[model samples]
Target chain A: MAAVEIHQFAECITCHAWSPDQSMIAFCPNNTEVHIYKLLADKWEKVHVLYKHDQIISGIDWSVNSNKIVTVSHDRNSYVWSQEASEWVPTLVILRLNRAALCVQWSPKENKFAVGSGAKTVCICYYEQENNWWVSKLIRKKHNSSVTSVAWHPNNVLLATTSTDGKCRVFCTFIKGVDKRDLGEGSSNDLKFGEQIAQLDLSVTWAFGVRWSPSGNTLAYTGHNSMVYFIDDVESSPSAQTLALRDLPLRDILFLSERVVIGVGFDCNPMVFTADETGLWSFVRYLDERKVAPTSSKGSQFSEALGKLYGQSKQSTSNDTVEPSKFRGGAHANCITCIVLLRRSAATTVKRFSTSGLDGKIVIWELDNSIDIQQPGYR
Target chain B: MAEEGFLEVENLEAIITRIEQKSRKIESLLKQSKPVEALKTALEGSPLKTRDERCKSANWIVVHRAMMAIKDVDAMFSSLDPEYYDILMKYLYRGLATGDRPTCDQCLRIHEKLTERAGLGCILRSLADTVNTV
Candidate 1:
């Protein structure tokens, strides 16, 4: 893009989720307030504010239909917000054991969610048949440490969870009220429970983030020492291979497309990598490495010199080693905690991508093919 | 006596003026590459205690002016030399470990400059680990 315009800047943006339709972004600034901004009239404006959480909001996700939003917070509660009577209201509240809920995600096809928390528990709450809202189906997993992150597969039939114990587990969703006696004799009740589909042992002691690929066949997770591991053939072999990635402590990973992955590293650089079906990987670009002119006086000469240096280097490097100049500055005032990219139906155009950092600033970058990335002044 | 004190003040003013004029002449002489004359005059015409003091005074002015010209943390760091960056990193590491917010700011200033010279990839992950530990 020629220039990235800051649509809305918050002082304490804790978490944000984009609508599946790419028309709105719902954000929780800290834990108590949730704001929804609609992209209309050529700008983003607040459409809803949810003020129900009594503690800091720790996790947020949007439903597949974009009609509902789920949030979990340190208040040990998970809430579902739905559009009702032209306003957003808390349609459901699932109270868990008296422990802080760290993350929540909605199932792709069904109105179900998986909530992970500090209590070493993973609760699967679904919409009740009689009531219009949701109810908790608490599953007390035997995890030694707190669950750090959770994700529901696109099929809505599987859930992936990670913990500080350095293990990634995939669990199959079990239908509610299903009895073990109905299946067969000598069948264990644990089989009636969500089956642990797979588990991966990691070298690092902590798995801070975990995400399933869009195809639901592969998984990617990040942990200590800046390691990002990718598990392919999760369904067939139950074995995972570590994908070679640049050495940086990755904060979060998002599958932008089947082949392209976007990740934010602890070093504050947003990286785009492409992987083939065989698991061979290639680094596409480092978003923060894009050259831009210094906006101030003290480093103007240095910036110019750097730009010239890059230009000279670009000339000497082979075409395969060089990337398009369309990269923009991904600099943040503090450590980047999260990143989300929303693609339009065409997938060629990026509707909006946001990055929030420790400095409490959330920036929305709008991309258009018409804008040239080669302009040195475009930051 | 009061009259004697006034006479001493007048003499001091004259000495200051003379020093100022001589310093300007020395500056011109240095600019013209007359190093011998410039060094001799700077040494003999001024009452300054040592060359180190003169250098310190000059550095203070440079620092004050540089600070004034700077607009942000990035600007402040971009102007610093490599030596300052090294000192800054040491100070920042110490400050961050102590949980001193003021030291964090100071370190951040140095980091901003280093980030300008280098990319965020060079310093961010290490800094994050340090902060997290603190």
Candidate 2:
């Protein structure tokens, strides 16, 4: 079993993000305020509180290279935060969205970001040096329903989005002035701005989280109906494979490697899925090792026997310190909403990740690949 | 009031007559050892749209007969189209709901093979759909 670390944050965390150096953390406590915590010796100390949005914050992303934080909320606005001296300041972006924004993510180059909204559009926002503010360009008329999540491809040009319309689409977000003429190979350079490259209709229900693999060769997303789809060959013919899970639906997913992915959501346990030598995807195991409650059958039986010998003495059952009623087996007691990669050994392989959810607890999990417990089709 | 009730009864009778006709054709195909064609005919024009219990049960009997008559599970699934997987799952659930020992056993046997052939999405879609209840 992997080593597990737990932290108590708030009543409920809507979303969270880690700093570039992994020293401090920021999260929304299911409210309008965003709290930034600094690690102080053995406990976390509240260092900053960002209060600008009038509604609940939905998504937050801390840029890895430039060390900037971007946040979106249901108030149809987004803010980019930068550190000045000892305080963080917010720069408002004119998203021009009429409805609430659902999710946000920065591009691989940190030059732009995308915000999905209930207005059936994605706002690709970038810094404007002349205006001294961030401006957005709308990709409209492609999504017929509310856009739920957005993920950027590694090439920094192609953006993948999932929506309530039961479709995942890959669109080119290349702007002439902002993007270079020639990206790397397979950068989808020929497509115009906002041109959709592919639309995958594998789910019959609302699709939620979406992530592109490290190599940008495959795309994965989850549906409300407890199904996950992986599509390959995005620029050309897109082929898809669907894996239906028996547990509750997943809200978010992260690609640990090119072959491994960790999915977390309503099941309250992080699930791992891996691909084999033939590239056949299958469910492997859950990261949550449900700890056996202290009240084992043998212990219960002994207590019962002792009670019988003592002629119906009630103290034996009540003497136990651990309340069995509140003892849940898994680490999380509620739905898991977000998962972020905390540490990675290399670009392609992940070493550590953190998951937080409605339970208001953040659980850090380490991946131990040395065991090679490749129990394929074990589900 | 009596006339409207009588018209609904007549509509149900017509639906039952059509179902029985289809059932006869499916039985004939099954006798010829063509279970795939029999299953295909059984799934067409399912009575799930109608709220009448008689029409649904009559159509379900036809579907259950065709499903149980098959001997080779893999051969039938190999030739089956993906479009029919969801409908087959619905009928299988209905068969299991009947609570008969042999019927449930047969339904579970087919359900396992169906899930293996068509991923778990087939079962999820079948269960999630509220419009087409068998």
Q: Give the per-residue Cα lDDT of candidate 2 at A270.
A: 86
Q: Which ten residues in a row have the lowest lDDT in candidate 1 chain A?
A: A178-187
Q: What is the TM-score of each candidate against the true structure?
A: 0.62, 0.76
Clashing pairs in 1: A31-A56, A31-A57, A226-A249
Query: What residue runs in model 2 are displaced by over 4 Å at the alpha carbon?
Result: A290-328, A345-350, A372-379, B1-22, B25-61, B64-124, B127-134
Q: Write the per-residue lDDT of candidate 2 for residues B22-127, one digit (tens) a residue.
A: 9999989988999999999999888765568878888998998998888888788878887788789999999988899988988988897787666565777777
State the C-alpha lDDT per candidate. 0.62, 0.84
The C-alpha stretches of model 1 lying farther than 4 A from their native spots are A2-5, A131-133, A177-191, A243-247, A290-331, A347-352, A365-379, B1-134
lDDT of 1 by residue, A103-189 (tens): 888777646788888888888887776666677876676566778888877656667888877778877676654212332323222
